[model samples]
Target: MKTKISTLLLLPFFALLMLTSCQQEVVDITPPADSEALSASSPLTALMSSASKMDGSKDNIIDNASCLSIELPVTVVVNGLEIIIDSEEDYKVIEAIFNEFEEDDDYLEIIFPITIITAEHDDIVINNADELKEFVDECKGENENDDDIECIDFKYPISFSVYDVNFQVIDVITVENDRQLYKFLKRVKNSEFLASLNFPVTMVLADGTEVVVNNNEELENTINEAKDACDEDDDNDYGDDDFTKERLDEYLQICPWVVHEFKRNNQDNTVEYQSYALNFKEDGVVRMRARNGDILTGTWSTRVTKRGALLKLEFDTLADFTLEWIVYDIEYGKIKLYEEGGNRIIMKKNCDVVIDITKERIENYLQECLWRVARLQVDDVHNEKDYIGTPLKFFANNVVKIRLNGEFVTGEYEIGVRNSGFFLQIFLQDRPNLKLEWLITFLEPGLIKLENENNRMVLRRHCADGDDDINYIDDVLLTWEWEVALYQDGDVNKTEEFFMYTIDFLENGWIKVTDPNNGIIDGNWLAYRHEGLHLGLHFGIEAPFDDLNHRWKIAEITQSRIELKDLNANGEIERILVLEKKE
Candidate 1:
């Protein structure tokens, strides 16, 4: 079976549309202007009024309340023996008939006592009271003893009632048999009719067989043929087997037989069986092998309680037997078989079987494992500067080595200004060396090496302050000292004395004089001074010399001093006197 979960996703949309449509139609009705102006009655209204009056009346009036008595037809069949319905009447009428039959010799003797089963009212719809009354009158007859008979056997269950066109409640009739009557009375109470007359019908004889006729014409023809056959069988027994077989043959010739097909199977032997297609005569009773072979013939019995068909099987010869059969379209074509208190087998159409995962894909998935390794190295060097400045060396694609020494350090250099000068130093495995120093005044762009080694080097651009014509020298030069004396006595005492000194440079037209007794002085002081000289003196007690230029100025003066002349032009002096001090 196919099953699915269904959802009404659009139900609200349809409901809203229905609500809108219902709101558009409007109906209005106005009542008559006054109730007094309305007419009291009309012809159709009178007829309805009469119908209501008749509905309140009853037929059998016993005391103040009206009583109702009804007779019904009944038939009974027991084991294929049909008990036909002959006459119907109320309780009183049937009692009278039985009493009359007991006294009359023309009536047949009562072989079986009339058995009372049940009495009940039939369900009916009556439109008016007249129709109910008519139904009672026709079934009861006039004065309860009329010769008109209305009840007859029709071979099936039936009931009758009377009603008007409006389908209102009228009287009702009930026809039942012994089985139906027993079931009916067991469900009800206080039954009235004790018994009713029912006739036993005989089969009509044609040739030697029994036949059935439904109408009068056919019944009469069957009776005449039975009379003729009776005369020919004066010496034969009517219930003998030969007579029965002959009757069966004649019946088969006259009546057509219907055929139906039933298929079966034997599960153990794997065989199939089937019956000829036959018409449904009555409830078909049959037993067939599961392998499509007829095994037995009997009445097909049905279990009303279980709601399933039953089959009986018996083996004619002694052999181990197994039976398997399939009934189609029962409980939606699902066949379940049970044996020994458990389900033995089950068969169904359109089932699913499943298997999982393939092998090649699993093998391919297992082959995908990998391994890898990683290595690391680190170095410690004394010449970090050289190592950083040196060009990167590669011994091989994956290996590298760096070598450095004091003399030829395989390292790098740095070119930049330092404390003493603009310098370049090399980083090496040993101590690093300064490659070059350009004095502040002598900075230039060139290549330099550290410690006279070409292994560690640098190229740099240097700068300084001066005219471009300047040159620098590395000279170990000595400084000069000077002393001075000033005399306040004409005797030239050394007690009052002071000394001063200065230096000079001869290159690049620059000079610097450094002195402790005097402040720093720049420029060529030798060219500016006329009479003063840089001097050194010895302190002693002696007469001050009047020849000042001859004693000190001769050795201290590095350049010649210019002489001054007298402007008056006189050639000789009278007294040759000089300042000489007695000490």
Candidate 2:
């Protein structure tokens, strides 16, 4: 008796949907006994409905967002049984699909195996006889590196009957014995469909002679010789590699290797190598491709040293290239070159291991590009681009830097893990009680989206023509009295005795105004937010000085000038104050 195994994914509208959006409702519907056209409107409505629940305030961007993201696990229903993908075989299939998506294609069609039942209902035609061994082998976990390391065999072989454009039965093949099973698995590469076991069952290979053999590895070894004969020339570039001299030779062969990442002298010099290439020939010659198309040739060789293997390159054009480094075990995805005194880089291979999406990763993702307010609705009012340039930046050591008006303001951030995954918890140093929590719903290349309990934010990587050189602002603000370019209403003139007080903004949200007059007035200051950021102070501070007590909105902060405004309920300005740095 042959078991029918087949399934068709009918997610018609959710093209890029994944596990993160599992809340996407699937309309209740049984598999059609005959056939019925399904509509996409139901699922789309559910998705839109789910989005409406978030707070519509985009201006409330605080540390309350998460960088957590999850991928969809393999799931498909077969022969009335739901199968959750838990083994490497399933992961391989999913990985194959992802790789295929990068290539140009109109649609994806997968080969399926099944048993065809006749209209008479009494008879079943089975066509998986030739495909059974491969399925059983895969279920036993072949070439598996991680979780699915155990061997498991199903009680019986499963297959699906092929269907044509008109849904007409095309073919069915079944395996009655071991010899046919061997032939099926041997020619698996040529076959369009690789077998995926439908129902979950566990056993050793021996169901007596019908079963190929007993014990998992023995069965795999018995058929591998035949499988290897067909796969000699077709293997993944890195799959067959072991960390040996031969592997290193293969890695450095003919192609121009671009230094994708770099570090030197306690500083990241990756920008120096972006447009250059380092080509190491087998004959000991290394050719360097300069940014201006100048060919700066160098000699390179690998030698055994007391530290380990050493990668030595000598280039006359660039003295920095003439250095030696001990080869640490190459990992973190790319070929890692490490030297003494904290210098190393992960080369061309796109292999950067991120365990928990660390602060550094977020900094790299955000700092590389400036992000503008894509959608900002605060108190049911949309916030236009009142600010300019890349306004926000995430830095290491749990810090967040933001540019308001022309000055740089910074705060703190943290990530927490719960039952599902990770979440973001953010609050400014000054406003500790105003904490924000957000579930990190999605992240991808060039885009990061955050949805809070009350707000939804979408920040596109800004591609404007400006360099990220906010360091100069830091230099000017290092120590300055808030004076010089003073503005009251529309007055862009100087203020008196602003120099008597040495102005200071502490990272912990403390603003100390100390002068001989009333001794000192300590106030809580908050910055780096979208909505009203306040400085709490109501003491001997006077008129123009009383302006500091209002709920202030940052207009611009730069190295030389600072602009602030008193905000009313509807975002109308009540007053404006400008101050220049006292050098």
Candidate 3:
């Protein structure tokens, strides 16, 4: 019954292609020897090397390709699976459209294959003309239903010809600058008129000499001449690899290093993500082990930038280390990285722990951050609403502080084993006999679950500073639950059944009263300062609940208790009512 809901914090993948404008130089096909993965003679390599301002992202290619113009008898990799593309009409139509490349025509009128994903997470692959028609028909109908696109992963390294605004062939784009070519393709997807090209796309030789090709024939000749240079590109980074999990396990002689230092904005924060480690296998798989033994799997690769800087780690997806980090140095058991946002992290050997696994992990996790009780469960029934405003904290000295109800209760705790299982024993100063033994059920950086046989409590790491920043009036009221502890009209005592009814203030000048006898009653309530020393509430409701409908003056207010006096227009007290915030 103990469940933890985690909200993913994803670092967005983004990049900008920087362009440099200059006059054409003499052909220098002397293999720039720029990137480790790309050959020197590749035209893409030469053009990319010419960029004066290079960013971390455009330094490589990351894209979702849906459109492609595959050459007949060419091999295409779709989701890491390679297949041969024969002479097909749709491919031919796209090829013909490029053949008649006219810049002023406003658009290329491209009809390439779109990656169709069904609602059940299956791909719709069309092999022939009939299948293509069927797929399109199904797609048109799918618009009305939930069956839609999972993603549009474009067929990368698609042999496509680049044309300028004049409809004249500019260059043949291939896998050499696959990263830049991918960006251009993404831009073309949302584009209605691509008359103005975005990529500083000029075909060139290895020596930065611009290649001028007026027609598709010339561009083809140019690319063919650079074939040997282009062949050296590593398609592994292109996500077209045959490496499986078993293969990677057999391949890695050692795991990636652990993060020993984390600095944001140039400040050292080695203690933030305590006990962080990463395992980047040779097969491009990345695994992260961080606070409280939570393991996250992602993809990482190393590529040489055109500027000839240090080889940087390129990550696909992660919560913390989100962008391309420059590897300052990486050795057998140590690695240093610099993120684009001026944040840096260092890693060393990740060794095994000697303490009790659950205890040590949970203690370290708690010390690194503040937590709040999001839910409490007893016998599988959730009682989260009762402790709505409480926040918790754990220090390194085996001490814990819980802001319960309206008081801060400091407690002592111990991490030990009992009956072949792990237990967290919390001894509150006020309640010594009532031992709160919580079984260590679940633990993560931002979430944790502790359960006994019948009780479970789910705590969440605070995303921002605790709601303590909220001022007392409306903001504080919205954060906490106020309940009627006692109600009276100077003669009758209604405090006995106070648990059966509750009053909650609403933002829209309304009040919702939960009644055990009835169901729910909607009324109006307002609280404001009448005089410098007097706080007033205008409470109004219908029939049986009519006694609470009176202009009341607040005599005192505290974290747990509130005192109000029923008063007439003359400001004379008739009766007193008391309320307390639920713990």
Identify the leading candidate in terms of TM-score.
3
Residue-wise C-alpha lDDT for candidate 2, range 352-410, written one tens digit per residue: 21213443455567566545434544445444232223245556666766554234577
Candidate 3 overall lDDT versus native: 0.46
Ranking of models by lDDT: 3, 2, 1
Off by over 4 Å in 1: 1-5, 9-267, 272-284, 287-300, 304-311, 314-338, 341-583
Q: What TM-score fits each model?
A: 0.14, 0.24, 0.31
On the 0 to 100 scale, the lDDT of residue 523 in model 3 is 57
Error of 1 at 215 (Å): 42
Q: Rate the local accuracy (lDDT) of all candidates.
A: 0.24, 0.41, 0.46
Name the TM-score of candidate 2: 0.24
Q: Write the per-residue lDDT of candidate 3 for residues 1-583, one digit (tens) a residue.
A: 0001112121121111121122142122222112221322444333322221111111011111111112224344433334444433333333233223222231221124433332222334445445444533433221121211111111222333333333333343353233343334333443311212222235544334566554334544565564333112122122112233343233232644556678766556776664566666566666665444445676665544542123334444544576566554333455556655557776776444212245677688878655655567766666554333345568878888765433467887787776635667767666432246776654556666676766867776753334332235545455566787778776888777567676676653455677777677765443433242222232333444556654456677776777878777786767887878877
2 versus 3: better TM-score goes to: 3
